[model samples]
Target: MKPAVTPAPPAKDARRPPYAGYAMAAIGAALFASKGIIIKLAYAEGIDAETTLALRMILSLPFYLVIGIHALVHTRARGEALPDGRLVLRTIGVGLIGYWTSSYLDFKGLEYISAHFERLILFTYPLFVVLFGAAFFRQPVRSKALLAFAVSYAGLALLFVQNMAASGSATGTGALYVLSAAVTFALYQLLAKPLIMRIGPQLFTCVAMGAAGVAVIFHFLATHPFEAIFVSPTLWGICLALAFGATVLPSFFLSAALKQISAQANATIGMLSPVVTILLAMAVLGDTVSGSEWLGAALVILGIGWFTLSERKG
Candidate 1:
């Protein structure tokens, strides 16, 4: 009798480039950059940070709910066990740190700072990620990574000095808030990858976002009246855009990208964010950019682009 043969494993698509993961990270960063612009627009209508955040999470919740439910059902049909309660709780905690606390601080900071300044400050999170990862996770810091870090942060320092000189004392308070947000966000970047690898990216995003949405909603309810959420149709439209475009899409994209790349690489790729935010703020909010800001931005782009190319080659 002839022996039965097993079919060969399917080949990976050679047409798809290795850099696709980097492209996903870039797209995620660009979409996330729009978030500050949209939130600033909502604030222009006299909405408070809590209310704007509430509206964003409210609009965002349904999508996460649907996706979360679908992912559970799909996992069950595939005969897989659900994530344990401990991992689930840990993910929820990370979500709260990353999304709820960080976002709240960020929204509050925006009240006192320009979107350009806010984004640039937030861009420092990658430095925290690299530092924390080396300290806690024992990840080695390569010399090339140090060079990239130095170049990027030197540019940020230039922009920071320029912005700080132009703004009021309130800038100090805002910078503190956003800097705290950056730290928590950096922690989130460190914690998320292993969890994402265990569960799929879609499921991980849904669970994390679901927990964050609930936390934001509860915080809003505890502090503010429902009437606070009522705003002009235009404001609602802006919140809708912020929710779907900035929050939902980018969350999923970043999660998926994490599955393909290291967190440090993801954070470095996100340096594109502040530049995008600067341009959008200029165009939409009539915010002016200085020659120094332009030079600093050029430095940022050069650093990130060079780092990305080197990573690809490596």
Candidate 2:
């Protein structure tokens, strides 16, 4: 009998992406940028950050609860055990820091600075991830990662300097708040890496978000009256967008993306986040964009895209 012929190996260029995860990251990044727009719009109606945050968490809370319960049931039916006590508590802690604290800071900063300014600062979270991950987790800092970091930050620095020259340092308070938000979010990314590996993205995100939701609930109750819910119709509509579009969808997308990609890689892809916020702010809020801002944004885009491509090849 003749020997059976073997099939040829696939071409190198034919390597396929884990599309679901990549889509999640890209879509989630856009949705996150959208939140800044929505929050700014709501703030126009005179709502404080806490009230806006409470509305978002409360509206999005049920979705997280259902997702967590569903995950538990599915795992149980598959004869897989749930997360242990330690993991659960750790998730809660990370969630409070990442979601509750970071988001609160973000909204507060938005009150003082423009949406574009807030987003640019918040986008620095990836750099913070590089620092904290290396320091705490001993994650190797690759040369390519460093190059990408330098390129992206150079862009941000250009924008910051130009904005300062034109507008002065009046936004110092807002910048500080947004910077704190970025750091906490970076901490969240560092904390999430191992946890996502163990418990799966869905369960981990659900648990963390739920913990954050509860914290926000307590905060809102402590400060605001029950009638605070009865905001103007426009603000109410903005709240819905914030809840579903920004919070729920992006949370799922980020969680799923983290499952397939390293947190640093995922965060690097998010370099486009500020661009999205800038465009939205220009259209919705009439924020003026300087020539320097345009050039800076281009640099950021190049750096992030180059890094993402390099990672895919490796």
Candidate 3:
């Protein structure tokens, strides 16, 4: 008699647990938040923004290369077909635009603006997050979320004014540049989320970083003298820290977290990053942000909390 047929094993579920996702996101945020403090140190040592970007990418290249190579190996071992060239090309294009351009713009803005206020506007990524969610995911924005976004943006406005005053800039021109950086960053994050979904976060990030790194290296060669990179050990140290801490660690953790959480949740957690950045700046750099900035941060946090806790109708 024929033996009874055994049922096939159930398929693996790719969806990650919510708590795990949120935790990874928090870790990513912490790593990213620390970037400002490191950059300030690098700047103090006379490493200009372009050089910093190049060096950071240079330092980060190995880590991403390992991940990318591993991805290729794993796919080959599993006998799975290669990923589509079109997808890779798309990632390369978006990565160049998002990672390289956005990073340069942010560093440029930071030169003319306070890190804390740059973070404040940067936190406005949630606005773009929601828009992306609505447009791509077809997520219905609940009223509470709308309210939260409004409150947070208001806080951003306050921080903007404070940043201008702190910089002693004329007519808030510096703030406009900061705002422009924010807008570009929002676009990048939104573009990245979907791409990360298609390619596993680690593989996706590795490739993206590779794309960005290549672009930056070319730009560095074209525009600036190579002498800036060899200036001093202190510069090298800061650049290494920026790579390991700011780019590599944060990108990996954030991508891992994205596996579990929606883009909106990621954006919400991102709001906390600037607050952490501000505290670190004060502690490390002896920089002073006004009371209004503090108040604005508090409001932004509260708004984010309210949005997270509120229920949405089906």
Worst 10 residues of 2 by lDDT: 304-313
Q: Is candidate 1 or candidate 3 better by lDDT?
A: 1
Residue 292, candidate 1: alpha-carbon lDDT: 93
**C-alpha TM-score for every candidate:** 0.83, 0.84, 0.81
Candidate 3 similarity to native, TM-score: 0.81
Query: Model-by-model lDDT, in order?
Result: 0.84, 0.84, 0.77
lDDT of 2 by residue, 103-163 (tens): 8998888887788877777765766787798898897777887888889778877877776
How far residue 160's Cα lies from its native spot in candidate 1, in Å, is: 2.2
Model 1 error, position 172 (Å) = 2.1
Q: Higher-TM-score candidate among 2 and 3?
A: 2
| Candidate 1 residue lDDT tens string, 56-118 | 998998998899899999999999999999989988887888889999999999988888778
Off by over 4 Å in 3: 1-27, 132-142, 170-174, 252-271, 308-314
Where is model 3 poorest over a 10-residue stretch in terms of lDDT? 305-314
lDDT of 2: 0.84
Best-to-worst order by TM-score is: 2, 1, 3
Per-candidate Cα RMSD to the true structure, in Å, reads 4.7, 3.8, 5.7
Q: Of models 1 and 2, which has the larger TM-score? A: 2
